[model samples]
Target chain A: MEPAGGSCLLGKWGHPVLQAANDTFRLNADFFDYTIIALYFAVVLGIGVLAKRQVSSSIDFFMSGRSLPAWVTGLAFISANLGAVEIMGMSANGAEFGVATFHYFWIGAVPAMLFLGIVMMPFYYGSGVRSVPEFMRRRFGTGAHLVNALSFSVAQLLIAGINLYLLATIVNRLLGWPLWVSLIVAAVVVLSYITLGGLSAAIYNEVLQFFVIVAALTPLTIVALHKVGGWEGIKDKVQPGPEQLSSWPGTDLTGISDPLWSTIGIVFGLGFVLSFGYWTTNFVEVQRAMASESLSSARRAPIIGAFPKMFIPFIVIIPGMAAAIIIPEITNLKSGEGDTGGATYNDAILLLMRDLLPNGMLGVAIAGLLASFMAGMAANISAFNTVFSYDLWQQYVKKDKPDAYYTFVGRIATVAATVIAIGTAWFASNYDNLMNYLQTLFGFFNAPLFATFILGMFWKRMTATAGWTGLVSGTAAAVAVAFLSEDAFGSASTGLIGLSGQGASFAAAGAAFVVDIAVSVVVTLFTRPRDEKDLKGLVYSLTPKESLVDPDAKALPWYQSPTTLAGIGLVIVIVLNLLFR
Target chain B: MSTDHDGTTDTTPKKRAGLFDIRFVIAGLIGVYGVILVLLGIFNASDEELARGDGLNINLWAGLGMLVGAAVFAVWARLRPVVVPVED
Candidate 1:
């Protein structure tokens, strides 16, 4: 019933109540561990300094001058998501749901990413917009653009706080610092590099942090898997249910409790609505692809990112699944036995690291945790400042400003956003499972945006009035659903409906998608459409064949073609799903 | 996907990563950690430490693996550096 035959483990899941102990970081991170971590911080700051020299103009700062290679941006694309959201959130899902958590990547992420690469990237890249809001401005005009810019900036700040809180959690665990002090320090570090070098620094650090995360988790997974006695060990122990062992009909993860509805929820709500909405429209991801050197590279970035994205659940989810049996507190939590001190599903990865890893390896894991958090937070801040300066401030507050003036504003925006993120971190800390909070945010922001975008892109008859009104109504509907549903908004909810946990978010997303499309369509029939000339590159039917894809693609090899590469990715993901299923 | 060129052109080359390659940065940092871990495995990896990992010298093995990965990245950067074209 304890952490199987070992005793050296000391660090526990950090709780504010435990702060009075004054020595909460009981795990042994000695001389070698400190050196390795110190080396990591040095490299991170050094990369920021080097990238600072590359910034000469606003474009260089905001969009990396659209000059990064496909490989760099590809890794950065996945890495940006690799933050606390992907690491802690998904792992928490894995611990709670077992192998069923594979649905997030295979079902929720991969197909959507391939869809982005094959379909959406060309419109984004070929149109030559700096950010997604600019594309909205061109396609639907000022109303939708203003709505998108404000909502997106607000969304980024809130999400950035999640990453910031988790990053500060590591500092709190590592040096036993108080959470508030750690939050400020972590926010400042993410802000400094981003403010100094802009997107290039963010991208470069992201690439390295990607590897840091991979390296950190690889060892932790191996050790954890070995400790739990591998696949058979997991099957014998951690026997939550048959549903937990398979990838189908994940009633536990979705919290729907019915087999058919859970399957439908995973496939439609998460796979179709939430995932497509997130991967295609959310600028946190789109900006990475948009930074690629050429349109060809831009189209390939997400596909290339998908290859690695296919297998990350192995390192992330396995350790979490093993945590249920490996950590005594988590094992206690896994059964109907409730509240084992302060351990929640979110502590699954941290608990595994504490029990399984020794000093040197422990340092690597800690560094990786920090890297992932910073990567996620940096991604949000970088995206926030860009949208704030370009979309909001430039258009409404100070039009006709010089490029240099905007760049200065962007740096200022970074400072302001990071500070605001520190404040928002309090809200994120309330959720035991971060995924519940994150998926709700996505349902609110991305689902409506995707509905508006897909409608406008395909049906050119969709008027400008339909665009903004649809967004507002869609978001309002999702809000209403969350408030109406059982415990979607945590303490703020009315708990009137049957849904809670991630299932509530799924219901809200589906409602948003359906409601937005219906509203946009009804409004479109009542209003005037824009001129056909303005809709060329923005609308799919009106765009020329040449602009949608590289005209010279036929001359290139199979590997160079986006279609060929995406096809390969799809095959691999399908195979992975079936094998796990 | 191509062989490494001189990273120069008649129209003035501006490398994608102007100062240093991302590969080198990753390789160097991971490789440095590998060396430190390798030393720790040799000198400080006690029997008690080994017991915690189920008799595996995780530091030594993981360190060696990282070193190999570092070498692969170094060679990759050497063979095919990023070829980005910047406008004047």
Candidate 2:
């Protein structure tokens, strides 16, 4: 398990050494950098003010009044998921695990995004549901709805808090700012736009933030490539083996180090279970697609997003791979238990920024980092507010409130959620291995969700009772596997199923999927099926063809169809996998 | 299918002034960052900065590119202001 450079023999306790190494990595922001960041904040605040006037009703606040074009929603859809953790964590993994990290994007994200657009959007958009849980209510009844809503609300709060904590920590560590100062500054900026402008403001800023991130980070990547002498140099320098440079799993050289998956695990565990569960069911991402102007536009949103999602690993992951070669001392440092005076792997992106980027461009890069963190927090907070206002509050606590009253409540919910998230962030700070725990938590939530959605949407024979049972048991199965696997196998073991963290998650999800399907099919066979008439629009077999098709799309060329576009994206992904392999 | 929750089809178009549109925010950001980069590249950058960028003024070029992008967004918004249709 030691790094290729070999272990540092500094002592059993590694914190002091790591702390000293961290101290060596400092970024001094000049006035120009501050000005650029300040201007970014001001522009974001101005957008919030303008968006505020647009929010006159709950629909406007929660769903952008369902009026955005495909392109806008598409960019925002992908951007909503691009948090600070994703940028930093992916690079960290790239540095630690190498090209195997590409599995997260290609196998984990692409296929699922396409499936959401091509198959799932018709049910979600055409059903006239305000939230994902509302669709659950329509298809699976009140019990299933409550389960989904409660889990989603809690997950969003925790995720938002984690993002907030991580971003502030990065700022404190890299720039020597106080943690509280960073937290307060972030809270104020995020609260202003989201409270005033609502979902529209959040989505618009996500798109803006997406561009800012690309503009800022793209140059850093190019510079890093140059510093390493180019792609050829990266190949020669990044060590251990050629597997570090390749994307395919289970090759002779890769089998020993890369735990991404076996081919079976990648197909079933990642491509089917975890990916489908996340991209299809996670409301934080699906909310953007739901906001599109028409059913057709909603379907097109994820397809448009898929193209960009495919390339993101290059921008985010490659830098880490390069860092592994260029800064092995820092990249190789292991945290916790063993004592080494080296930076943790999570510090990869910040290290790259500090070491490579100059002053003015450095400011832009930092602003991009800030924008990404805020975008992530905003996406989660916005989703939380909407689910709370509609699913929990309006459904149970207060009924038939005026649209204006619900809008007011949504804003109040946003504030409440942000406070709760800050508390969660503080709680999470106690954990030494936050990322590992977060992955387990996501597995607990998402694995069973895709199973429920798949059966409920496709199989009319699936009873509401079965739907509820499948979700509960499936989630329980995922949780049980995560806990039991850690106990049965040593903590350092690859996974219960002998895979890396992501691969283990996929293994857990695959187990959950099997459990969910078995439970759902057995329960449905014994119980009475829902009347077909009641399942209209929610179930695939019962929905009218008109509801699924966009008439306008018929006039476009065959190449412009969402299915066609997704196929093109898939082809590109395959080519990339082969090229890298 | 196109009806709002109030059970009526929404047909009225909501017109936003160009200044009030989100594109304006996007343009403002690009312009601000672009100008800063250009200024830094032209007047203040040291020889080390120039060398670090591999003898190309990345700040200058990237800044100019951003400015062009901002202008395109501005002109596009002016030519066709964002109008949300209340009805399908």
Point to the candidate with the largest TM-score.
Answer: 1
**In model 1, where do residues sit more than 4 Å from their true spots?**
A1-25, A426-442, A491-496, B1-19, B83-88
- DockQ for candidate 2, please give it: 0.28
Q: What TM-score against the true fold does each predicted structure earn?
A: 0.92, 0.90
What is the per-candidate TM-score for chain B? 0.75, 0.74
For each candidate, what's the DockQ? 0.47, 0.28
The residue-by-residue lDDT of candidate 1 on A216-333, one tens digit each, is 9998888888888988888888666566788887877777888999989888888888788778887888899999877888988999999998889999989989998888778888
Error of 2 at A541 (Å): 1.0
lDDT of 1 by residue, B1-79 (tens): 1112343446754454423788999999999888878888888888888887798888888898899999999988877
Clashing pairs in 2: A13-A339, A14-A339, A17-A341
